[model samples]
Target: MIISLSPRATLLETIPFPAVTVCNMNGAKKSVAEDIDQNQSNDSDSLFEKHMLRKLCRDNELMSGSKVNASWSKMQNFMVKVSQPCHTMLVACLWRSEEMPCHAMFNPEITDEGMCCSFNKVKRNFIYRNPRQLHGLNYTFPYPSIDWTPESGYPPDAPANANPWRVFGPGKGLGLTIVLDAELFDYYCSSTASVGFKVLLHSPVETPRVSEFAYFITPGDEARVEITPKISTTTPDLVNIPESKRRCVFTSERNLRFYRTYTQRNCELECQSNFTLQECKCVPFYLPKDSSTRICGTADDECVENVKDITEKRLPEDYKNRTGWEKPRNINCSCLPSCVQIFYTKQMSTGKLEDMFNVQKSFLGGKNLSYYKQNMAVVHFFFVENYFTSFEKGEIFGFTDFLSSTGGLLGLFLGFSFMSAAEIAYFVTIKVLFSKLRKNQRKENITQTRIFKSLPFAE
Candidate 1:
């Protein structure tokens, strides 16, 4: 008769971390490690090993530069829980609207003092000195010529009488003295008025793209510029606003009418100048209060309302039916499909640098920054049970299997040799026990026969 024997061995299988507890993504929870017995029951190990492994795992968090995996397990009667790692990040606007045109020259000097007339001497005298001084001083007379002044060609009287000009005094440098001398100004009373100015408008549009500019004219320093929308009639050149800087121009004109200085306020929202020639202010693009058109759907709407809506809506019913339906499933991928890219901790990668800048630009971005910062620490968990099972059950496979199996050849040889030695010891022990049993049986038989012969006489 032949006896068939079943060998006893251990096999391991890959299992996801069992459900232990539900951990809120926003909930603050401390990390913990657990040990299990051969039957997968909780067992305690020395504090040193657990502490060391945890420290090692933590130090190798992905954000910390190393990509090592950690471990987790489900509690028998409780819930298996883990922190959800934040993935979405933002890249902020690095460029700003630069050099917004402010004050400009409207009537740049053309044909010096054409309005001077012969009688303008009194006005020129007034322009050169105070009227009180002219009347008070003793007279020294050689009345200057009225017709075509040597240099200006117009009579000197023209400059004095001209509403825009005044005697500012010698050494102080002569200039047209008026309250309305903004870089660009319009006059309703004068004919043949020369109006030249450099107009610059602040834009939120990004660089490397062409955009249009709108011009508005207003009377005072109001927050809003009440502009009369004209087509090409009031259009300025479409200048290239460089990255992080504003556009500039040196413009001059001798004729302008029916226009007011394009005015703006220096307040918080409307500080960005609308028109005229002035130094440009480097303001950020798509500010919270900005009304300018933006490329990312109304420059103000960073998330594109559709994307915002998706994030705001509750999980769909169909999704809820899935194992992880209560929330969005965590799907981590990398440039390489075969590589298991695990998120180890909340960390900021180079990718997040741009996002930080974008968030700083707006109130919403500011609020979100805090959230991203808190969630940057994450940990990835991996189970080694499958590896151990594969090794024990001789089911090694995959790219790792080839190397592991090759490296484990020595262990396999040693294990087999140990088993063979044990078998030989067992066989020798069994033979000795069997031989002793036969010898005892023979001695018992002889004693029984001797007793039977001694009792024969009585029979």
Candidate 2:
């Protein structure tokens, strides 16, 4: 019988057979059909063996092990629950495994400072710190420059030998100091905020006499600040201004007329920890159990604004006792600066792996503690379990610490070996080169002395 195998078979399932033609002694078509049936069975056995080998290799520990591995059918079943921005390659492997926790790999990246992670976006911007009190939006500005030209020949009313300095006093405020047009400054702030981020503005230059600082808050948007030197005149009416014991107003030498200049003071505002963990139970927020934390009511607006206004009035002991000052600050025509921006729109959350996986527990030595503290602002959001400044202490308590003990020991050994070897090699190379050069110089000097003595005797 002549057997003809189809070329459409998969590589793993292909049967080992040669194509053949039946002779006229027997019906050629019937013989070919029998051979084709035999080859089909052979192909099935090859495919089954290949499938088993693949499964075994993928599951072997320390061979081809991963977090996710399973039979083909099991993997397909797990795919129904996959719905995040995490790596598809990981998901593809994970679908085969049914035992994996959804959040097994969702932990944050731990830096010296804290946990850093990229956000859930098609193109993710990595956040090194937790989103906290100091929120900011990214902004860009053109590189600034100033071009100066003197008027050719003085005007008819010019004082002879007059310098430009004579026209305006340095104290009079109009020399050649650079001041941002208020419109451009405010527009920058507003534009940054429009992209769903909080923004703070500080005057680029000091203007000494600013009574009411005028800057465009956004394009075509304007904001004014009023400054008063008198302590009793009332601190700038802004919401949630932290109270300070000193009432002295900071003064600078910039010569410009402004009623007030906005200064972006950096500070931390924290959510007070409640004795017990309750759902969204945060300071400056009311939680009555029935109302969702997200469902903040109209009364919340009044309370929040009051907290801001009252906090600014560093109420003296006497003022604190007074019933009248304790009452919420009245909001009228005066608009209070917003402490936080609120958006009512829903946004699709992008999913990403938390960055703190290996480093937090493993990476150590050097001034890592201080380095972490400096950059703590970047990744403080995820390791919110413990507020300790030290990661070593935090690790002991298991506050978002995910690194293995072995990784830490290995890292320390490698770090010490690298530094020690570098130092020893550097010293040895320097010593050997110096010694060889000194020996060569001594031989040359002796030869030159002998040659000079012989020349004199011959003369």
Candidate 3:
């Protein structure tokens, strides 16, 4: 039997395999005409070679570069667990007319900003995804599958789920009104140097960093954020162009190994993780890294801090002049921005909660309204209007336009068009032959007239 390999195989792959295929020669050999099939699993040497080959392929991951993928896993194995529970952070929650329990409303996620309670950011498969699988599942955030994207909004026939799902505009009853109980007494060191909750609206695909971007909602004051959903997308026509040439990657074009959905923030985070790994030899606990990628411990704290400072600090060289004689961030990251992006821009309005306390008391089950007014912050999240301006990136001169225009002529033949080619053909062949035929006909007529005139004397 002849075994053929693919022509596209590299020079290294052209080598003959020393390992032999294991095939049964008993019953199959009895029939001389029958073909024998070999099982690859039975070949111990072949199996070992394949396994080693796979490991060798992944060996390059040890090196550092931009656009490198960072693994993102659950924070269950980390030493830090349950620093601050969701119930403690969010005392009360209200979305539209429905009231959600503090524990069930938000899903817990670990970030650089410490304990985070994510709202409407969990996987649709599970209501509350328990970090430890042995503990079993909990239906804390009992909602339908979120089928919304930057390219496509919520389905027209989607289930009536919650505030974000419903798409309600600016109104007290229609939006998400949450009363935050900022337990400032237990505060040790405030990162923002203020006593209040940091309110942030970001893509559900992204990990929210409090230090990166946030809007502070001070305690005892009601802050209403008039959300204006911003969307930026590249035209579908640009999909044919190479990602490297376009300088932007579509969701399907560049997929992150850790993230299910690709976003600009996700790309940057992944890039940062790889850069950190390159400089410090280990990545931060918060960054998305696989088990193989070493987690930065106490020993690597200094290195990690230095890397963070380099990335976070605003430097003219970072943005203004990329090319320099010697740069600290030489190979920072070759990450291209995502073709599509969605951001929630908020316009906040603040006022003392003492004035809006009487009506909110009933929502709190008639508890100590006077006490909550002093310690609580009611935040409302709603759309400012039904319509908002969104940006779209498209090709100015498309392929079809080029083919129809003078550009196509230059591509087909140097400095010549279809009209010019047609004119040349007419003059060189058709025009020359037609003129010769007319001249020959005229000569034949003249010859016939002269012959007739000479023969008239005989008639």
Candidate 4:
């Protein structure tokens, strides 16, 4: 008997082996049929051992692929839940005790905290994939910009540059007082299952991520934050080095596609968006991406997470199990941090609020403190000082400063300025001319006197 293995061997539990023929051991009356059958069976077992293990691996891959496809399937379930709108999240916002329009001061933004309002954010050109499809979208919010940049200073048209900082709206005192509502009823679906808000203080150039870092402000407690500027300026010499060697991008090198500035956070956001789009065919709304790109919804959560896991290289299981040496490929962004990084250090103090009787009547809003206490949190965002000393060497020591400093040093060490040296030259020239005139006059007088005395004059 002879066995021949077919090409398609994965579906069957057993595969036929290659043809095998038994030869006689003693060359006299050897067994033909039963002996050949036994040899073929042995060969089939060997083939199963060699290829069955690989077939099992292929099965696992197919199963994993099915999961990925299922996650990518169309599901209409993920309608954006705008349970917390701007008016809902922000109960009241005050600039130095005067209640200002919250909608005017803040623009409705999307963060991991879900439907957040951002204040003092730089204006960016953004578009939603499905703007009209989103219900409860705030159409009245205004887009704002400081008209500021690292390369160029603040707007020059504004009168008086005394402050040298952006702390004007609330004057020299506390900046803005904000009351947040952490609706406790919505906690069932949240991962944290807590009553609070995640307060993140970051630059206007960056898109804040709740996954990366945040400070939690619990409900019913007032948090007072005194912000001090933490700034580091880069010298102009660093610009000469290549970006690969220096590992930091400068203001002049704003190479980012979506943002006007190139920050490390922004670069990472774009990198993540592209990578996620490559893996999952979509990107999250918070990421800065092209308008044409598809936005991810609730159904794509698994694929997004898998892509994140792949980028993070959190595949130690395969290594530990020694399971065929398969590992996730990490996403390489090759993004470097910005050379000029502006940060703020905040000193915060918290205190519990008094109950309904002691609480102010304005905050009560005809509703008792029982309703307010379960949902409200107040934050005092203030500047620690009126002015900050930022030693931006890029703007300092220009051609004019260099000339002025050189001349000042010459006057200081050598005791002479350009004007003083010019004055000395003028005086010396005038004195020399006067002395020559006097010599000529004396020579003429002497010659006349000698001639008069030697000749027939009356002496």
Q: Native-vs-model 1 lDDT?
A: 0.22
Could you give me the TM-score of model 3 versus the true structure?
A: 0.63
- Which runs in model 4 stand beyond 4 Å of their true positions? 1-80, 126-146, 159-165, 169-172, 297-302, 310-330, 356-358, 389-459
Q: Write the per-residue lDDT of candidate 2 for residues 193-224, one digit (tens) a residue.
A: 23111111111111111111211122111112
Candidate that scores best on TM-score = 3
Q: What TM-score does each of the candidates earn? A: 0.14, 0.16, 0.63, 0.59
Q: Rank the candidates by lDDT, best first.
A: 3, 4, 2, 1
Best to worst by TM-score, what's the order?
A: 3, 4, 2, 1
**Best prediction by lDDT:** 3
Cα lDDT tens digits, model 4, 65-101, are 2212111111111112222556666777776567777
Evaluate model 4: give its lDDT. 0.53
What is the RMSD, in Å, between candidate 1 and the native fold over all Cα?
40.4
lDDT of each: 0.22, 0.22, 0.54, 0.53
Error at 23, model 4, angstroms: 81
TM-score, candidate 2, is 0.16
* lDDT string, candidate 1, 371-429, tens digits: 43432211111222222211111112444666556547745866545566577787799
Expressed as tens digits, the lDDT of each residue in 373-441 for candidate 3 is: 665677777665555565676776655666676557674677677777788899999999999999999
